[model samples]
Target: MRILAVDDDLHMLQFVAGELRQHGYEVISAENGEQALARLEQQTVDLAIVDVMMPGIDGFELTERIHTDYDIPVILLTARHHIEDKERGFLAGSDDYLVKPFESKELLFRVKAILRRYDHPANNTLTAGSLTIDLKSYELRSPNGLSFIPLKEFELLALLASKPRHVFTRDAIIESVWGLDFQGDEQTINVHIKRLRTRLEQFAPDVKIVTVRGVGYKLEADS
Candidate 1:
């Protein structure tokens, strides 16, 4: 995927760009938000990583502009860990937030996760049998209209619905959805799958997320 990394600090910008490149992504570097905007005007980027502090056009404003102009997904990087900063980032159209001094692996994982979620074709809608997933709005409803799914539950459902009948090992599911950086164990995936199944039971009582004995989990669309 093509990514844009913008930061006033030349070293930081290069560092992030190099890291992303190492991960098999095409990366463009910019020294500030204005430069980043210029790059965007010339090329299409799958995602952008912007530092919050800059001399001209701070990260928030930059993110707002990108959202308004390109509808591009952005991941904000900031040294400031304040809750307010995070809230502002989201309000300004940042799809994700990463505090500075973050692990390279963590940064890569967040980038991949945000891009995956943003670009997921199954997002906003997915259908398997009578089940439907509203990924953009984080809602899942059944054909019978007897159930509602919460956000996390709906994420789990959407992940399964995207690849009908494909078995996803717990580790793979956690890495794909929760992200590789999530510290939770395989049991977390199990719990969410259980809850998702409970909600799905209301509409398609026979449809289920099945455990493969010693293998993993699979969504049984025909069940």
Candidate 2:
């Protein structure tokens, strides 16, 4: 999963980013709320951690904008621990609040909890039509039977399946699945698509990952 860590304190931002990365999450860092907004426009992350005390576009305002514009979950990482401050954080649409001097493990747990709740995988499986992708069980099921889904393939397919029939451009796919800093080209996407097709052919024939000619790709059911 990808997380955006926004704070004006460079040291704090770096610490959060490094900590999240150590936990196997892809972390994006922004020095302030303005930078965070710009990063959001260019990258897609599962969650955001914002510090409340910022020079401008304080964490509360940033949280409101994030929830409103991106519909992404946010956790307020502020020093303020007062009851009213937390109320404002929630009212601003923060899914959770963590005061400074927090344990990294606790932050990781909260992030996972929110993502698990929001993404709401089908008991760790995602299904469309007769096809199912079981993340926990590491099995893909269809009318034909079951097959294995590799990590990148699963991430890519799941992303596309998250919004069936909605075309995803290569750039968007790269940013979403691979991180904005991934040093790969369109061939990377093509290779993953090819492999995904090979795996899908083992099970789901009616369900197709269609490339829109010059555009990108989408998942569709032959109806």
Candidate 3:
């Protein structure tokens, strides 16, 4: 998963980014709120960590803007443990709050908790270009007609479509779709990917799953 870390303090920003990166998450750093919003325009991030104090936009306004514009969950960081600040943070749409001088483990724990909540969205259907995936019915609908997809294939497609253009590592995909105890060869993923490619070609021509060489796969759609 990718996280955006925004802080005016360079040292604090670097520390947060380093800690998150050590745990296998992709980190993007921004020195201020404007930079953070610009980064959001350039790429997709699963979550954002914003400092409460900044020069221009500050964390509260930034959090609200992110909540309103991007729909990405945010964690607000404040040096003060004031109840008012915490309340404001939540009112600004922050999913969680972290006080300054916190343990890295605590930060990681909160990040994991918020992300887990976001992982399972209430919406059972997903849209990708001209295709709509009905998770409940296991149906793929396109402009042409509805197509039946195998359980595994449907799951794989849904996973990729969940985060369009975000690179999902092979290990992550295997663990998520096949479970940690899966004993099947990696070729199983390749076969399913090939089949999915053919199905997309026939049903949703505008949507394609591109291989990332040594990485796993990501779904791309024509905008």
Give the winner by TM-score: 3
* TM-score to true structure, per model: 0.55, 0.61, 0.64
Best by lDDT: 3
Candidate 3 matches the true fold with a TM-score of: 0.64
- What do the candidate models score in CA lDDT, each in turn? 0.80, 0.85, 0.91
* TM-score-superior candidate, 1 or 3: 3
Give RMSD (Å) of candidate 3 vs. truth.
Answer: 6.2
* Candidate with the larger lDDT of 1 and 3: 3
List where candidate 1 sits over 4 angstroms from the true fold: 123-223
lDDT score of residue 194 within candidate 3: 97
Q: Tell me how candidate 3 scores on lDDT.
A: 0.91
**What is candidate 2's lDDT per residue for 50-105, written digit by digit as tens?**
99999988999999998876667999988877999999999999999999889888
Question: Pairs clashing in candidate 2?
Answer: none
What tens-digit string does per-residue lDDT give for candidate 3 at 63-141?
A: 9999887678999999998999999999999999999999999999999999999987788899999999998899999
Give the least accurate 10-residue stretch of model 2, judged by summed lDDT: 120-129
* TM-score between model 1 and native: 0.55
List the candidate 2 regions with Cα displacement exceeding 4 Å. 121-169, 174-223
